[model samples]
Target: MGLRVSKGQSIAVRAFLSVLCLGVACFGAGCDGNDQSSEYIPENGAKIGASVADVMKDWLEDPDVPAAQRAVLERVAATGDMESLDYEQSWAQYRQCMTDLGYREIKLQKYPSGLYIEALHLAGTARQESKYEEDRAQCTAEHVEYVQAAYAMLAGNPNLYEDADEAVVDCLHRENLVAADYTASSFAEESARGEEDDYSFDIRDMKARSCLASNGHLTAFIGDDVEERLW
Candidate 1:
């Protein structure tokens, strides 16, 4: 899960609550007993999507990937599910780490992507705040960052799209939320106007909202079908 620190509310959480989101969660999950040393490689095939095996194959060769991340990848490969990455557990670890650091009332919000920071109450002198930043960085890095990325690889845009906008546009079209004559070009134009004036499709429209939420956009204007957790 990714998090943003804020005093009043979280931008990501607010955006998430505004749209109806949809997701499929697999019930069964497990990982193969793969030797996770320098000799490790992803022999397990893709369980979630066709591309996951390929992604795991590439990441195995990248030296920057930490053992924790690689282990999560192996689990994802074995189970064909993002939950195998165990990001929620890691987020809990992160939350506990922050709480132990003296941060009180660390509110969290749930999103289709995962847990997000709804609010954080940070108070101290400038020097202490600076030290807090350093600690937050350390805690987040050790607990959430890479595991969250691995989970996102599956949870975000089931199509594994490189462009979030394009994925959302395609999803809108696939769900028949837009007119048959609507083109990506038209959507692009609307997006420009939408940003400048917030003139996008009415977020209150249920189909449109769900399409936007699932395809990875348009979850910032309405509220339904979500969970808010205080962490």
Candidate 2:
């Protein structure tokens, strides 16, 4: 048997159909091409979100910000939170603080190479000082001891070795084996190349000591136990 539509249900169905038809016509007219003056549709929430995203993208593209600062901002953005960049104004304040301390922009061509030049200059100065030479040699020796111990520990523990990446393991092995070889090869290389800048700690500390006090002896004794005086 076929289903039958009752008279009362048919009347209700006509009313509902009439309402739906009116709604469709209203929606179509409201969104017609004639409404070109409307910049956006209130029904679409995406326009506002997209505009905000574009503004943020533009801000991120600004090159004046330091690479470190940009890295942190990018990490925050990657977290999918927009509110984290509220601290950006605070970064401006921080930059002003750095500017007050004599920070300035340098060309990339002159940046790290300039740093190397300065380091070499300081190292040259340290080489001129006897006391700095001794202390730095001692510090280097202590560092080498640590390196040797690290390598010894790594060798005995193969499972421990597996935990670290190959580069790290290689570094440990190199540290263990390189010290003697480096010392030997350095002399030959220096002999062949002529004396080049060592840029060691002796020169660095001597320059620092000079800046602080005229009496290098007194400055060197700055950490001495004054309580040991019996006289």
Instruction: Residues 7-45, candidate 2: write the lDDT tens digits.
Output: 121121222112111011000111111111212112112
Candidate 2 residue 130 Cα shift, in angstroms, is 52
Q: Model 1 Cα displacement at 158 (Å)? A: 1.5
- CA lDDT, every prediction? 0.46, 0.24
Candidate 2 error regions (>4 Å): 1-54, 82-231
lDDT of 1 by residue, 1-231 (tens): 211111111122222322212221111222122111222112221222347655555555656555666677677667657673376677788779877987653555355345343232334677866776677667766675555544544554345444434444455555445544444455557554544234234444444444444433433432233333222
- TM-score top scorer: 1
Candidate 1 residue 182 Cα shift, in angstroms, is: 5.1
Error of 2 at 222 (Å): 55
Which clashing pairs does model 1 show?
Answer: 15-219, 18-222
